[model samples]
Target: MYDYLVVGSGLFGAVFAHEAMQAGKTVLVLERRDHVGGNVYCETKDGIHIHKYGAHIFHTSYEDIWNYVNQFVKFNNFINSPVAYYQGHLYNLPFNMNTFRELWDIVTPAQAEAIIAVQRRSITGTPKNLEEQAISLVGTDIYMKLIKGYTEKQWGRSCSELPAFIIKRLPVRYTFDNNYFNDRYQGIPIGGYNKLIEALLAGVEVRTGVDYLKERALYRNVAKTIVYTGSIDEYFDYKLGQLEYRGLHFETERLEEVNHQGVAVVNYTERDVPYTRIIEHKHFESGTQPVTYITREYPAEWKRGEEAYYPVNSEQNQRLYQQYAILGRQEQNVIFGGRLAEYKYYDMDDVIKSALECVHKRL
Candidate 1:
């Protein structure tokens, strides 16, 4: 019998299996998908690595987590400076001086602040919904041109109908910095995320295209402890209720030219446009290949069969997840970890940190 039976060979499962193996434990990693790397999987085309699922930029302030990933593959300096396109106008992201200059020709911070301050005064009382919350934080222009369309498309609802707490803090920068994340370390692995997953599960036995839930009882006896990284609600057969999530559908294209969009990511902040953003894959690694690949991300309503990308952290969903969490905790010798289990939107670094912490505490 194996020491641990790890379900879902994503980053979390890979890390836990790696740790368990390092401590002289046998691990059997079962992935429901066909590949090993999970959502971070990349497909190589014409020497250019294409982010198959979506663009995943590794960024984190935690030094240990940064160092942990670096041991597998070398990372190049790739700062995520995604641009936003609204009504045929291009603006620098993160609401910086460059964006202000493009928006209203305001060079200094005071001038930009004055414009925002004047616009913010339009809010009469406490913010009622996401629309009011956003206008109260960053004024009307940015809200209409930048935030509204994208937010609406993502959650499949208008900003006026969404929760006010969603726009609690829109990251605005006084500096001209276009770098999206404020992390110390940010970049993709040299070849692809597959390299990192391969290195992590070097000795661990992995079976892809295997659905553990189909024969969970049989799999449970194959190992001493079970580390489940799938949906917690599904683990208990959705006894309480089904949690909600926001999904995405990608349409990728192979362009004949060397580069499609100069930048890696571009946000289309227009309500008329159906897709949220377009990601040029080669730009992530600065590849100079002859051909390029681009993917258009269309936000969609999530269901059980479709892949759940982001959790819908609505009050009702959170309440339902809490009921499931209590049931999950009662499972003997079973551990629930990762985004699906916790129902949280986790960055790459956060998932790695969580997996490491789980190993330390449980193992």
Candidate 2:
């Protein structure tokens, strides 16, 4: 009999299982996917590491969490500097000064500030919806070219239709820096995320191609404590109601040329583009491979049994999740963690931190 049965080989379950193993507890990790590492999983081809899910740049200000990950694998100095492509023009991201110069030929910060201030006055008083909220923050110019279509593609709804609180903070910087994340620690794993997962699951038993809910009784009987990293609503068989999510379909291709698009991530911010962004996989690690691989990320609607990517944090979904959370708390033998289980979005570092906290609380 195992002390802990981890439901998914994702970061949350992997970290908790690793901690449990360190404490000399027997752990069995079950994953529905063929391979591990969850969303951060990468497949290598011709010496290029392609981000299977999407471009994930690990960035965190948490010192202990940063140190904890570095123990498993070495991290590279790859900073996320995603460029936005709009109507045959590319602009630096994060609403920085470089973007301002490209957009309005402004060398000084004052010119950018003056232009933004005048544009922000387009909306007055309290913003009504996502459209007004965005305009009130960055004005109509940036909203049209950078925000509108991209966001529409992501959420499958227009900014006008979405709630204003959805886009509470749109970071606008007046600097020449193009670095997307403001975190002190940021990079990708040296080899790939698979190595990190392998290290984390060292000496721990893992079974892939197995869905816990399908054979919950069998697995639950084998372990004393259950670490569920799958969907919380699904764990309860969607008894109350099904939670909503936004899914993504990736169109990956291998280019004949050595380099394609020059950068790792390029956001297609135009409505005509169809897809939201195109990622050049080789650029993530500056690979000098003979061929290049790129993935065009197309946002789609999420349905049941389809891998839910981003949870749709609508008011109804939140209330439903709260009900599930209450049910989860009452399940004395089970633990619900990670993005999917919690019905919330989490960065890679945040997931690790939460997993560690769970391990501490349980053990």
Number of clashing pairs per prediction, in order: 0, 0
Candidate 2 lDDT over 173-276, as tens digits, reads: 98899999999999989988889999999988989999889987777789988999888988999999899999999999998989889989999998778899
lDDT of residue 188 for candidate 2: 88
Instruction: Give per-model TM-scores.
Output: 0.98, 0.98
Off by over 4 Å in 1: none
lDDT by residue (tens digit), candidate 1, 1-363:
998999998899999999999989899999999998889988988888888889999999999998999998999899999999998889989899999999998789999999999999999799999999999999999999999998999999988998888767989998899999999999989998889999999988999999999887678799888999988888888888888888999999999989777999999999889999999999989999898899999999988877888888678898899989888888898989999988988998999999999988876
Worst 10 residues of 2 by lDDT: 211-220
Q: On a 0 to 1 TM-score scale, where does candidate 1 land against the true structure?
A: 0.98
